[model samples]
Target chain A: MTSRRIESFVGHGALILGALIALYPFVSIVRHALGPAAGSNAAGPFTLENFTRAWVGGGFSHSLVSSAIVAVGVVVVTGAIASLAGYAMAMLDVPWRGAIMGVLLIGLVLPAEARIVPLYDMFEGWGLLNTYWAIILPQIASSFSLSTMWMTTYYSALPKELTESAAVDGANSWKAFTRIVFPLGSSALATLSCLIFLYTWNEFLLALVLLPQNPAVQTAPLSLSFFAGAERNTQPEVIAAAAVLVALPVVIAYAFLQRRFIQGLTEGAVKG
Target chain B: MSLGHRDVAAPEKRRVAGRALRSRPATRRAHRLRTTAWLYLLPGFAFYGAFSLWPLIETFQYSFYKWDGITAAKWVGLKNYIKIFTSEDALSTFAHAFTFILFYAAIPVVVGLVIVGVMTRVRIRLLGLLRTVLFIPQILAMVVVAVAWRWIYAESGPINAALEAIGLDSWTRAWLGDFKTALPAVGLIGTWVMYGLCMVLFIGGSQKIPRDLYEAAKLDGAGPFQEFMAVTLPGLRGEISVALILTVTAALRNFDIVWNTTSGGPGNATLIPSYLIFEGAFVTRQVGYAAAASVVLTTLILLLTGGIQALLRQRK
Candidate 1:
């Protein structure tokens, strides 16, 4: 009993230490962001000046708005399309289903880096560079495969009787989907939306390349890097403040919807 | 709810007319189902093809041509592929990605196993809170993570301050800025980002294992470590494969962290293939070369993940 008790103590000790280490960087960021401007030691007087400076200097107000539009656009578009595709794959009898499934699997595995060069060219050809569509369109494309896969898995796991009963009552596929399947899919939709939002908000490289000279279209994360670069010689607090500002919304969303976020990400992995 | 019921019932009114018109109602129903499925698939596939599939095909096509973003393209088959293989810098960048697997995949899995092992043996309180805390890094923007870690590794940053406090003042240096330590330092940041994911996966996997197996191992006189080796390890094969595939891909395609932290600097110590692709396409305007590098990188990722999947399947 004593040995077991001692083991539990050690395990708790290790877990606590690991947790603190995991959280320390965020703590440090908050400290530096809120603390005085001069030193790395976060013990000096606290001030809102760093945040205000970062807000104005980073041009984050505009970038944050851009990020919101992109994130929301990706989520809405990806979620709607993915859910439809998922419903088809899960509930309907489509010919060439295996080939479609294979395509989606390939799409899921293809890294964004692989297609980025040609995407830039393609978007440029379409005259979409520096436009919200450039970012939103690609993000939706990349996220669509996983989102569809997720919803397919979700729909497959759901009881078939729900849709079947509706179908038996002479309801068409579309009516059954809207009246029956869609209501039951609220959680899945929420999960997909959260995942898409997170991906779109955190995307940096695409925004950087596509919106190169346009601060108005630059995502918050991309803008934060430029902000930090411009102020490399300045106080660390300012940079920390900007970092916090860029990360704030997603962090807040995660805190509130952590269950959905975790479930969506891990479930995607399991399904894949 | 009433509206849903009415909608559901409304379709029944059309059933008599359809039944009276079609002698082969079953075939017609099947056709309708197929049509509906196709309709549902069209919008998703349209966006996917226009953006992802077409771009991927275009990347492969671009690899055979010599074209800047602006100038007219000249077809140069196999030249870009040959260059990617022959170029010393390109080779180093690929090598660096393999090195990152150590930090991104191996270390995190090991640490995750240890943590999960401990948690299974000794139940931890507030497990959800612990998970949330550890996972914060995974959720944060890579740029923000890089910025935070940059400050943490700065000359006057917290790490040096701690070292000075501990009388290891001589050990203090600009970690990311140092060539010798830059790659490993940046890779360790990946370790930090990924370990939570590994832990979460393993913990979830471990919970699915039947408890009786552990009890049976104990009854057979196995100690904790022995039980873990005999029971837990084999049980986690699927999760381990998933974790490996995810982390290895992250390691190989690691651009954002390297870009934000070191910018593949300190004498090319941390340049990964993705960064090279970006630099080639955007900075140096070597579009074909970048496309080749991308193709190679994608192949490498597929091979690694496919290899892991094959290994796990054989074990199963």
Candidate 2:
């Protein structure tokens, strides 16, 4: 009994220690963000001045909204497309399932770097360069592969009887999907939506390449990168504040949907 | 196009067997089913095909040519591929990427295993909350992570301040700045970001392992270490493979972290192929060379991940 108690004590100790290490950087950054800047006349240890300064100085007013637009667009479109495809693959006897699955598997393994150059040229040719479409479209494509795979995995596990009964009740495939499978898969959809939202929200490479000319369409991270590069040495606090602002939306979303986010991540890992 | 039609028709024809003229309504239903399935796939395939698949093919084609983004192309078969192998800078990017695999994948797996090993022996409270907090880092923008870590590793950053307070002043230096420490410092950031994912994955996978195995091992007089080896390690194979695939890919495709933190600098110390491709294609106008590097990098990623999947093929 004593040995068991010691083991439990050590286990909790190790977890607490690991948690502290995991959270230390975020805590330090947040503290730095709150503290008064160099040579600033703030009566207290904390100030909102850094956030205000970072917000205006970093142009996050434009970038954050821009990121939101792109993320929402990608999430909605990718979700719709993936659910349809996943439903078809899982329920209907889709011809060429193997081939389409092959392409998606390739997309899963294929890094973004492979397609960025040609995508840039294609977008340029289509006169969509520096537009939200440029960023949103490619991201949808990339996210769709995983989203379809995820939804397919989800729908496959669902009992066939759900659709079989609907078919006997004179429902076509589309009706069966809309009325039954789609609603039934809400948890999986929520999981996928959160995953897609996070992926699109935090994306940097595509925005970096595609929207180089247009600061209006530039993402929060891109703007923050430029902000941090310029002000990193002079004012670390403000940069910290800017970093927080850039990370705020996803952080908020994660805080609220913590269970779904973790479920999507871990479940995706196991099943991927 | 015709293959799908023939496939659907073939099955229907077989069901009728001797009937040369099938029921028109039944034939129509099969056609409708095929059309619906294709329709469901079309929207996704259109975007995926145009943006992802077509560009992928074009990337391979572009690798064999010499052309700026504006100028007319010139065929330069294998020249760019040759450069990736021959150039000192190009070769080193791959080496640096592999070094990151150690920090990102191998170390994290070991750390995760150790943590699981400890936790398996005892039930800890707030496992859910702990997992949520640990996982926040993985979900954050890499740029945010890099910026935050850059501060943490700064000259007057907390790390140095703590080191000084502990009377280790000589040990403190710019972690991301020095050549010797730069790669490992950057790599350790990968470790910090990835180990939680490994732990979370391992934890989730561990729960699915039947408790009977552990109890059986204990009944057979196995110690904690022995029981873990005999039961837990083997049980988490699928999770470990997944963690490896994800982290190793993240390490190799590590552009965002490098871009925000070092820009592959202090004189090219932390350069990886993804960063090299971006710089080469967009910044330096080595479009073909960039394409070649990406092709090689993608091939390496597929080979490594596929190899992991094959080696760790999960038993039914």
Clash count per candidate: 0, 0
| TM-score of only chain B in every candidate structure | 0.89, 0.91
* Model 2: CAPRI class: medium
Clashing pairs in 2: none
Error of 2 at A9 (Å): 2.4
True contacts kept of each: 0.71, 0.68
Among the numbered candidates, top lDDT falls to 2
TM-score of chain B of 1: 0.89
Model 1: residue A67 alpha-carbon error in angstroms: 0.5
Docking class of 1: medium
Question: How do the residues B123-242 of candidate 1 rate in per-residue lDDT, one tens digit apiece?
Answer: 668779877887788789999999999998999888899999999988999999998889999999999999888888888888888999988999999988998899998999999998
Model 1, A82-117: lDDT tens digits are 989998888887789889988987777788888999
Superposed model 2: Cα runs more than 4 Å off = B1-25
